[model samples]
Target: MTSDAQVLAAIINALGAPKKIPSHPPKYRRAAVAIIIRIRPDHGRSSAHSSKRRHRQQPQPQAQPRQQTSLSKQPPHAEQPSCLDEIVHPESLDEFFAQTWVQSGVFEILFIERANKRAGDHRWTGHVALPGGKQASPDEDDQETAARETAEEIGLDLADPALFRCVGQLDDRELWTSFGRDFLMVLAPFVYLQLTPKSPPLKPQPDQVASVHWQPLSLFLDRLAHPQWTPMVINLSNKLAPRISRTILRPLFGTMALHSIEMPYKPEFILRYQQELVKDTDMHEKAHPCSFSHSHPPYPPAKTRTVAMIDHYPDWDPGHRPLRLWGLTLQMVADLLELKDGPIQPDIRHKVWDSHRMRKRLDAGHLPGFSQADMHFWVRALLKFHSWQQTEKNKPSESNRVGSWESYYRMVKQAFVFVVLGRATAIAVLVRMLRAPMFRMIQSSVPSVRHSKLLK
Candidate 1:
């Protein structure tokens, strides 16, 4: 054992060693932001292939874009604010991406932040952004402030900004200013998780989010509510059964005094909101007897029901896109066959892939004309080809989605896995073909797992 003096010297040296300064410094002021919609698994997760993410694949989540279908009827107070109260006016605020990382079908997107230093225009700034910073609470009426705060933070969903409803509100505390004027600031937070408009992902506010997602409530809520169920945090009650413990906490009551008080929504909010939409207080919404069809709306058809919904997003045209087909494709095909003997497809060809018709055939309990064993063989062959391509000298490796289904599906939900990984990867312009199938897969599961089937 070292002597006390020696130990003390070591400790001093450790402390004295030039502290590992942050690669970037805080060059800007702290602004008010509400981390709404924690995860957008729908668009998948992506990490820049260049440089990003601190904890390798940190949740690359974003608020989903609004639907364009019903924007003309947007409410007057729903529009986000435009005045440049804090930072300079935003030039562009779309969700953009660099390269994608697909690990076992999980895509990770990296965000952009002001690179700790204020004087540079480095695009590779930092991640977690707070683009929305403003007085969310107005005088007696709070719609303008709410709309503005959301606009500032999440401008991606706002070409027709008035569509965003001022549904929920959270009030922050007051902070004293240097001039002795008490700054009555209430962190105004709003959500667009279920916004209608979607496409080309609005725009990229390199300062807001690197990428935006169209996360479903079921998937999104699953993540926020089931955060590994930490022991220190509140234990979920058994009443909500599985989710009885974690439904969407809303109104959080905490001290109002602060530098910019951050608030939490009680879980009941998510559950209750879901109920209100279904129960429909009158002009609230239409009424339905709560059928599985409502819960999972996009079911192929009654005659075309299948044991599983295979997303064929990236597989637009198998013959033409086969060049980019990765090994995981083969593995999933094999699993379905193994589960249902003979082969999931006795009518469809192993090489030909089209999800729409495939969905129909699978539902009818009949393969279109594809050989199950042959499909497995093709899958194995594809996996080997991908392996060779990855190991080849100069070719860019497929450093994404694990090459096998064993990892892609994980344990939770296999069919649902690729939907996310595929979409996220698609955003980064990697494995382009997978995007459509992934989306189709998500649509398939929507009715089955969704808490609400209001999808357009």
Candidate 2:
């Protein structure tokens, strides 16, 4: 059994060596998200109290007066300390985790449920995601974008040296449409660790974040705690394709099957909107034109109204839905987990051709949220497509002309349809040719006079 400290060490080590992607053309957009990690006291642990007591017992150091240097004496272009420099060193991290109080704590990661869509933009609305947004002009770099977005969305400032430190970052990922046609943006994930024993109170911006949650990292690593993937069906009719294209392709592709992970633990909401937190049972009746009653809500009813009222709710639920990890956010989590646990096998390149073998490999490895059959196809397609992209990217002249994985997947889909239709047509022609000879033989078996009369 691995300790939480060991797991975190492995993650930090992985983040130290990130697979970075080069900046894309001006046409392509970029975004960044922060994966914030913190160790909180367990249900019965007194770590926070103990830490407070220890702080109170320690003697305070007297403040020293600052000596201002002359402007001429100071060196020009002196480099300032970065957030990365403030990160906990390996030796310090080990010492911190070695403490009894810190060892008893639970490792947790922060997540946020996005607010409802305004009008035209509906992407990631009400989705459980890491705190982040697109890159802005003021941001110094990609990592800065992550820190800025995190601070803007949730009031936990990653840049605050006293509270948090930049652990490192994960590999950059390119987002694509469901149909694999258009490229969306590149997503860069940065990891941060809380230096303090206790987490700071978070103030979620109501417009951006509907609620905030702290999910245990153990839930993602344990197979029994987090069950296998559940099917999330997508309607093809609601896609952005043209009506004529949809009509022609409806028979071949009317619906798409995706997978979602049902979070086992009930999320602890740090900050939530008032309307989402409460259930107004009498508000509907009071608002009705025919009703003229003014009733006061019961205390117990208000107390019992919580997010956990619905048991095992589906992902497609309209309002007050449970936290279901899926889509891009889930993929990011899996990527981090993969770093800690290592790959499923020494090499999965040969196994991509065999779906069953690959699925078995993923299952044996106990990879959370990736055991479904639907996911297997996608996993294989992406592996092959990425391999191809890498080959193309390496070529000198073709590197500039290389397309995204989406375009490659679309081409493969079109080819598959043509292959299926071509085979069907060939089989039909062969069957007709074979039946013609049998018909002639039956005609010969009939008497000459009867055959002639039938023909006439």
| TM-score per model over all chains | 0.22, 0.60
Query: Candidate 2: where is the Cα deviation over 4 Å?
Result: 43-91, 224-227, 236-244, 264-321, 342-456
lDDT tens readout by residue for model 1, 1-456 = 112222212222222111111212222122243323212222222222212333355675576556653667677644432211111222222111111211102221111232223336553333223335544225233334433554553353322433322223222222223211233333332332122212223333333333332222232122223322111111112111134323431111111111110112111101001111122233222343333455634323223221211121222233331111112122221122222212122221112223222222211122112122332333334445545544563433221111122221121122223333555676778556778889999999887766565542
Model 2 lDDT tens row, 284-352: 555664454455333214433323121122243244545777766876776666556442322222222
lDDT scores of the candidates, listed in order: 0.28, 0.60
Q: What CA root-mean-square deviation does each model show from the true structure?
A: 33.1, 14.2
lDDT (C-alpha) at residue 114 in model 1: 25
Prediction 1 TM-score vs. true: 0.22
